[model samples]
Target: NTQVNLGGGEGLAFRNIELGTGLTEFESPEVISLLDASQFRLLNLDEKTSILLTGGAGSGKTTVAIHRICKLCFNKHVLPQDILILVPHHGLVLLSRKILNSIGLDQIKVMTSREWFRNQSLRLLKGIGKEVCQDTPFRVSLLKRHRNMMKVINAYLDTKKLEIVERLKRSAFDDKKIVQFMKETAIIKWMKEIMKGDLSVVQKMLLEQLVEELNDYNAIREEIFKDRKLLKNIMDDQSELITSNVIEETIKHTHKQFLEEFQEEDSREHTLDQKNISFRTPDDVSGTIDLEDYPIMLIISNALNGGTINNGETLKKYRHIVIDEAQEISPMEMMVFGHIIDQERGSFTVAGDLAQKVDPISGFTSWEDALVDLNLSQDLTELKTLEIAYRSPQKIIDLAHHVLGPLAPKRIPISKKHHGGVLRTIGEHEAHILILINERLEKLMEQEPKSSTVIICSSLDSARRYREGLRNLANVRLVEEANFTFKPGVDITTLEQVKGLEFDYVIIPDLDFRNYPVNDYSRRRLHLAMTRAIYQLWILSPSAFSPLIPNE
Candidate 1:
């Protein structure tokens, strides 16, 4: 019999180690001890170690990670703030936040890259704006010069109206068109002459030109009777010409100067600023402020840097970082976050099934290569695999596993009483299939009494089509690309948009090869769609595409 020593530096090889010669009954302490010894051999945790927990859907990887975090926090005396958890999407953030809250770690903060960026931007804006305002005299002078240049241009045009009219007529222009054309042609030059060299003068000039152009349009339309087509063409040409010129000038002359100013202000403020603003909000309470108005990078930078130099104190402290749907995070972003945290002391957990990276258009793909790409191999100390699934039934897991190829291991045990559902293979007829799915959803809703039924599609187009096709169906809701809220009844949404969500019954309207190409990303998306059902899952695919599934 082979004997092996587990754990410790000095150990015999498993094949060479010998077991003691003993005949113990099954389920006895001796037998259980042997099993426990082998299991204990598999569990190893060391200081400053990185772990990769990989498994298919329904695998206990999440449970294991959570348990591991709890162990580190309670047993190891690691502060909750010292653990960082990164989830794939905002929806997963919500899910993880709920899980953390339920575990009584309510003070643990959950933030997305967007949230981090907004906080940083606000910090920069607060610090830089003061310096910017201190140079108010220069700005006011520039503004005044810009205003004078605009007045001169306006007066020049007013005094030389006939000459301007002649130029416009020569160019086959009407009064409305001529005014627009002159404004577009002369605005930039006028501004440039006024600033002497200040780029802001160009911005101010553009603003003045825009106002004058609008007033001119209004004045001429009410004052002059000109040909409608000519007026329209002139107005269109003028607007296009002015916008193009402004953009080109901004890029060529103003952009670099503005950037220099910003950099100068940033450098000065860095020395004087000592505080940074930090904002936090609960998942349920929506913030009314628009995030698009701020630069996301600045916000994240400030937050990760322990708040801006404007806020007196930093926000919530979190050490454990969990990034769910890890497969979707871009490598650049992953690198940024990895740099922000002290890897030796902080525990970063990334949970994502590679089989569900669907949003390739948004640069979303499997991040398995991140370990090598980011040179994180040295830091990754533990690689754990979770194979036991508790989400979907065995049948659904099986179907998803078949489509996901080798990535999805056949480890999830079959449920004893899975809610068996039909997998219909339709033909090129997508419309008829959608109708059938709608009918099934309606019937299911009538029978189930609850509004937990959902129709998940592979793409936004498919979701919208399903919604438009079933618009008249009562209690049926559609969640298209722009819609955020999840209403009751039969809801239709794309797979990527509905991650970390579940329904009592999920009907995948179309799972054909045409829709879900056998690419890395598409297959993962299909897997995500299949696994999002709690009780039953129905997949409708074309007969030709049925062979895409691996042999069970």
Candidate 2:
């Protein structure tokens, strides 16, 4: 429809190619050539070094990004390894890799940003000659509390000059389980005092065992001490020492320590011993390190500044980075990526739609805020809004816009004609809804036998329920975070799991108020679900529908 001149005196013509019926059943092979003049401009971008591409679902943002990578690798003579395509979730990696492989750019790295950041950070931390311990918030809190409680207990024993205390200390140090049990008991005591509620079955069992071991008269009748009376006195003293005040003080100290260690902007290293960071009774030590993404970024930043990571050569080379699903990237991640990317060369491209941002905790709220966080000048960075969606049908896009109400922008009309698409709702009894869903799937299979399908639910439990209910169907699998099977067959998964993915047919069960209420998040999620369907969409409910949906 239009001709665009590349900077090198070459011209490329764009034409209308209908996503016509009669494509290969396995994949949408036309995606590589689906870019229009507006989308294709990214491949020949020379006016600006950086670009921020904004578009709704199926707007060809990702397809254009992939093509741009090919352009750089093949046309511009860029190394495949130099290009980084950062997808939001792992589910998108499979398709991206496949696309890259199809075009002979298979060596290019396609990974999640977090995965890349984590690997680089760990390498940098090791290069700095500093021991690093990765830990979870829950385990960190528990470990620190236990450690501080033991400190208090040791200090209490130091003050006691009694011979019984000496024997207890020797016995405790000889048996590590005794000390570990004492540490667990501190957490149990704190829980009982703070919650003031009935303990869980596991906690109650722990408490009951602890009390029986330390407080029971017959429990400490062992022959470890020459005098049973002295051992008994030591047990009674230990019980008294682990009082409410000690537990509270230890917990308070743990909180303060965590705040100082984790919240400090200039924190270099943590004091926790990496060798012994386990709380379970059976394992004395665990080499498990599960650091958060933000903290890893912070460590990488610090390491780079200090000149320790890969001898400061890990990120020294300029990288052409493409960040997909940029809306969900946190400010810190954006900042770190900004620092890592070559600003002058303008080799960075980020594509995302804000309306589909489901991650509230770390997701950016606006493009302005996101740019500010990325440390980029608004005037310099070229902003491209892809108005025409090439993935989903216009009818599906219209339904998505309707669900989003005033928050969504009106889709720009496409001149090329296509099917109106199918949007149907089935309700009433659960049995009836199931029957209707099966019938619809049967009809859809008869029409397009190899069309990809997904049954998205509100929650994981709901997805499991639907997958079980629709078990009679062939090639159906329940998709979760661990097992992400984005295959050709039917996949039943949660809405969050299916982000940045498309299906020929999408079935959303239980479109009721309880699951999808009339809120900003719920409405946006519903919009995202509707837009994922390329040809047809089905909404199933049980005699009740979300008010977010229109009566029509």
Candidate 3:
């Protein structure tokens, strides 16, 4: 069960309704507190609820989600590991992880969509236990364990003194008799025998003693190789001596052959086991199988249907599941999660700001649209809205509202002092605007050297052009969205990449309609770019694009 606190100034108490019944009543608050306190306390534990939080920039949606998660973990007595928080990208996951860490709940793991899928696949494989082999992708119960075991074996073989000595002797040299003698040595034969078998306690003890003797011989050989003059003299003969180039080529070919043999043996061993192996897609039938095609929904369903782990216990112990930046996730991805929720009987909490979505290029739009498309709303019984602006000032918010128009939701009013700074737009003439912007930036730097600023463009070409134009300005750095770092200097970025970030000053160049035509997605992205300015905003564009702005 999840509880939400919609804090503003006014209080409205609303009751939770059943599936058929709508929101019953909007009762007036008995106690009208100055700070609006709206609480959503879940009464039922069995019921699974899906929540959609929609708001523009400055809204306290993120804060509410964080608080909600913390409340569930500490107050509700939910285990930290059970609460899985999903974010859009790796960056947001890190940011959320930092936030959670700061709040003393460091155990909460944040995973991106790709990471989550990988983890789920690993977990499902692990449930099958040692009945499955560790060679093939489908057969391997755990990828890390399989890889680690192979690595250990490889390391052991590579470090074996007898093997190393044999390899060195096998290299072309005048002393063919010495090489043959080394290959037939008793020590080399014993080492091979022990390495081939699953050694017991007694066998391992005997091998350790043999390894010690081998190390001593290895040290002696290494000391001999250390004498550069002796080595040069030994290989001095033109026809009798083996050149270093020939030795290197022989070793490379031998290593490649050895690797091929090892892989073939592994494949043979893996196929010997008669396990019920199946593939999700036909494409994964050959080569390295990608288990990602095995839908998460199916895995979760099987797990819930009395699938036991190695310990013979049912694998259904998670308390809660969280999906952050849910707006960017596709309907198929959400369905995978929805199945997990139904199977595990765990609570689901998805946090995302719909207006901040910018992944349309990859086919994901908004959570609202995704839900409708996926038919996930059939289970969703409650809807909540978080409307608080904690990051920006009122003046900045006002400007954002004016520029964003219909897209900007009503945010909590901030003080005039909190507005921080004003936006100054110079004329759109390239050279003149550049001079004015540079002058203003220089003056601001003089006043506040520590203050940071961002110069944004809608396209990479324009960003490059602006960066090239500003190369003459000393200490004025041009940073692209790809190369964005938290440095106390001027940064130039694009609108798409600058979402979910705030800057002290934002200089928007090439904001003309001709350059960036207004569309539903573009307008939302534009709002995101405009609202990022915490202190100041400078929008430079042609007079033709001026009509887009509301005529005051």
Candidate 4:
């Protein structure tokens, strides 16, 4: 244990030997102690049963889950390959993989829900005589869209669309040909920009027709010119020049390249007929199959509808399924998976806390509602709640509970075994706020270099601003979903991005009314951010604090 003091004699302890850089790394598998009788019992659950585990931050939910996997593998002799752990994001997937490998259960598979769904759908498709392309040409297209040149092209096309739309509105040309010309020009310009003026007749026609069907552009919206407002919004949006055209052209290029390679191999095979070279032609490539998110869901939904996955023949590989961060799983997704799971003898373990739900559009009311959506209410062998937080200090949990206000009052009292955490608040002018934060951070780093800290913000924009302001500092990074490295450093991220993650120290800068308003969602977000800190939490602001903060 290492002790550190943040100014004014406020001290905290961090067990870095046990925590090891972060939650993903553990020094030993024996870290799962038997002191928590509830956790011990949970690890020894019946082999063929399902469970729903609920807990708040630092409640050792994930610890228990990992230990349960170990117990199944070592104690019950369950094959490591027969278990699948589904996490919400790529970061958690990496974390789960590390924890499993640390315990010598590396054969267990860990995947994001999207990946699991796509792989399962493709497997089922192959079972029914459908040829699936293993190569993802769409990834190249996606990469191109995020490049700087694509932004410049999009800006240019947006300018042209606005000018053309304005001129069309002023003129009396009400013919459909004018609309077609405008759409044709946009597609031609986009292709020219992409291909550097090298265009083909077939490619041009395909792009023009396909641009209308692309979900992002929906060129059909501008077809009839129902209202000028709609046309203007569509033109300004400029979804046409953004990503849809790149995807279509890349797929075509990939198919063309494959055919050329095949013909070259065929020519070689003709000279040596002794060698058996049975091959499928590129013409067999299915246009209906795409690995993109929406298409993956569409294929899975089709399979579910056609009874391809209803029999659970393709899903018999895994006897146990563990889904962490279950709160983020939407009802529709859960419903689909529930239907498939019910068909097999595989048991599932889902663990999440409803209080940390930040997505308002998911319509995830409660666990009861989710079980009903999954059609697994009767098979829910246990509804276990882990209310004791073994790692977090009581002061932090108390403040987090205060942020929940009435909601906290209704739930069972969530207590922490550890005591004496630090909660510090500092108010300064907008101009000098960053300076104060820097001073405090420098002092904390000087005291404890290995302590991991995260500066939680209200939004991505806020996180970027803080990251830029503190760019000169050492080991400070802006965490994004694509590049979330949970290393020992000062991470700046939003509350949503930092969900299902914890840190040794969490700093909430600019905790004012503008950033965190007084509302239920905002309250939950603040609570979620507050609970991410295991040792200490700090709230800083330039003006009066948000009403959600208790005036203690």
Which candidate has the highest lDDT of all? 4
TM-score of each: 0.52, 0.65, 0.52, 0.63
Give the alpha-carbon lDDT of every model.
0.48, 0.57, 0.48, 0.59
CA lDDT, candidate 4, residue 388:
70
Where does candidate 1 stray beyond 4 Å?
Answer: 1-50, 67-84, 101-103, 118-317, 342-344, 359-380, 405-422, 425-431, 471-475, 481-488, 541-552
Between candidates 2 and 3, the one scoring higher on lDDT is: 2
**Per-residue CA lDDT of candidate 4, range 1-552, in tens?**
012345311112223113311232233223365226767887788866678888877677777777777888898557888888888777667666766777688899898876776666556433221223545454332422122322333343455455545544444434553465455543433432433434455544544443333222112112211222222232224244434444445445444433434433335343255674546555444322333322223223333223333233445446777888888775545655565553456667889887777655443557887677566755646778877775556787877888887767455445543434655555556556677777777887776677678899888988898888888888899987725665666889877676666677788888899988878788889988888776667887788788888776
Provide the lDDT at 177 for model 1: 48
lDDT of 2 by residue, 347-389 (tens): 6778999778765444355788777767678877778987767
Candidate 3 structure lDDT: 0.48
Cα error, residue 222 of model 4, in Å, equals: 18
Compared with the true structure, what per-residue lDDT tens digits does model 3 show for residues 1-552?
Answer: 011111121111111110011111233222111113553342222234545555556454555456566777767557777777776555456556666777688898777765676555446433211111222332121211121222322233334544445544444222543454344434434444545667556545555555444434223222222333223332333223234443343333323322322332224433347553343243222222222222322232232222332233333344566666666665446655655453434566666665666654223445565565433554653455655454455666666666655655555345322534344453647666666666666666666555567778878777777777777655566555234544455776667556555566677766677665666566666667777765555677633444345433
* Model 1 lDDT tens row, 172-255: 434664465455434323322434643344444543554344223212221211222222222233233323333233223222
Off by over 4 Å in 3: 1-35, 39-51, 118-318, 341-345, 361-382, 394-424, 465-487, 542-547
